[model samples]
Target: MNLLKRFAVPVACAITALAMTACSSSKDERRTPTPLTQFKPAINVERIWKADVGKAGRYLFSPIAVGDAVFAAGAGGTVAKIDGKTGKVVWRTRLHTDLTAGVGSDGTLTAVGATRGGVYVLDSNGKLLWKSNVAGEVVSPPLIGNGLVVVRTIDGQISAFGAETGELKWVYHNRAEPLNLRVSAGMTFAADAAVLAGFPGGGLAAINLKTGDDYWQAPVSFPKGVTEMERINDVTGAPALVGAETCAVTFQGRVGCFDANTGRPIWQKPFSSTSGVAQDNSTVVAPDDWSVITAFGADDGRQLWRNDKLKNRSLSVPLLFGPSVVLGDYQGYVHFLSRDDGSFVARVKTDGSAITAAPVLAGDTLVVQTSGGDLFGFRPR
Candidate 1:
């Protein structure tokens, strides 16, 4: 599947080929990916280590870093823990069932979801603790914190299970949209005791991590078009949580930030992205649907800079590193751009495969997982 195009279909056809057929029919009208150009290195990027979990067949699997240990899983039901500094495998476990989303850990308990609505929880030493089930297929990594293993299925159902005993705790159902994007929309932990998640139809909800209560709900974007396909405005990725504000972006909608406590709109701008935004204290960076990376002022929502060199390259989510924005592309090339001006600073290559998940910072090292199941740890110097 072309990750650059928006594959909008009904929820009933979530894992079918209807969305793929629709996207392929318009292949001739798609824009070509921009070619890379040579540039002088502004920063030196060092490859710290590399490891392989397994291949991610049709789902996006993101590796999670707890402290100095990194947890990663693949669609072949293999999960492993690696040392962030030495890149040595600590332990590996196989579940026998095919996994759809995974690698969520809190340094003690690790969790992964299977394609058949099965949720597996493991201890730190790679021992299977317990197993549970959900209503729908889990396409996003489960939220592992607050003593709960929260899993969100593709059918708008959020279920929470006990991290230790795998007992059913609570469930929350989000309002479903007629047409939705077949992509992974993830969840994040806010400063408050709540979980911030984006849903179909551009709705953002903050739920209590313990009691499954709604903190607040706000609209990131509204559907506005004549046809169903044109009006598909599902939130694409995980909502980013800063100190007091949380921000999210929609597929065919806008990017906006809201107060983390009250869910009030702080600022918004007209933007469309297939991935989420990464923000620090001063800037919010995101890639548009065409893969043009842009930066916005975190306070007043002002456009700062735009880089069109990666258009249609199927870039992953942008990670705001110390002095650069790190991202991976379709050909397994990691590109480092200056956070101030959006210019290339350094580039590196990995196994030739598409990287769909965002890069995570494990301590000071940036770790990224490719669809071919290779994990690379890079440190910018």
Candidate 2:
């Protein structure tokens, strides 16, 4: 949603042996994934339900739709559950700390970071199942995988906790450098059999969700005196598991492809975006400081097309689905483009709000929440 990466946290080391890396775009140089030769409904923006879940005091959280419920955490530690179809609040729970959670079909686990306290497990009906504290400040969302709840904190502490009994399985704390990367935002993006997390200290890291082990990590280092911080802003963009791997964008504005297992950089190139990268099945897209929309092959780091047509306007990350990827601009116009070649599709005006977070898909519905908190939904017209 924002323009950047998180490199401001305090850590004891620059690189640690506690997480893995997922490299994206390493096998090819300039080829898109083979054309899918398939089609689905054209993207029609629709609004299913809208609620003013008042922004959580925490700067990094967003509304998450899991199963049939829409879960949101408020700034004041209020948890609200809304019906996915009705937009009606089903129940609300209050916690001592604001939450970022990893949701699943069974249930969810919420984090309060290391300093604030521990992680909590919540039932779909708004019941608190259990809680276990960790070590630092949590800025990344909790990740649920392999019957374990994985939490990452600002102090470079990663822990694996029992999903049901709130038991501590393992805790791996990495010593970071004096200038550690701050995790103002990140998500547990699942790839292969692992859940990927960590966009810090020059690059990305992947953690084994089951055993609490580090696989591989790629340092996203930059040039001298060109602080990855001053120029880069937030690694707020959660990963999109595109193609055979999971992907993320750094604040420096490049589409990064990781191995999804070892956190190795398969390939990376400067993506010109004031924001970050967005992906459909075939292409990864973004808008630059010049406010241009560009497309790259999802399988390789080759430039496929650049649509300067979206010139000089602020835009959100591209939302990719079947044959179309849509983007909403600061002007409030949502644009639909052909997934095949970035050809001109239709552009529709939204509620005229600045688009921030990447658009999300709910069932057959395209859900876009504006910076002003306006939620718009669409289906094929």
Candidate 1 lDDT (Cα, whole model)? 0.83
List pairs with backbone clashes in candidate 1: none
Q: What is each predicted model's overall lDDT from 0 to 1?
A: 0.83, 0.55
Give a tens-digit lDDT track for model 2, residues 83-130: 666667787777776554322222354333323645666765677877
After superposition on all CA atoms, what RMSD does each candidate show versus the true structure?
Answer: 6.4, 10.3
Per-residue lDDT of 86 in model 2: 64
Largest lDDT belongs to which candidate? 1
Give per-residue CA lDDT, model 1, range 289-364, as digits (tens).
7789999998988989999998778778888888899888878999999988999999999899988888887787
Q: Which segments of model 1 are wrong by more than 4 Å?
A: 1-11, 15-26
As a TM-score, model 1 comes out at: 0.93
Model 2 alpha-carbon miss at residue 269, Å: 1.2
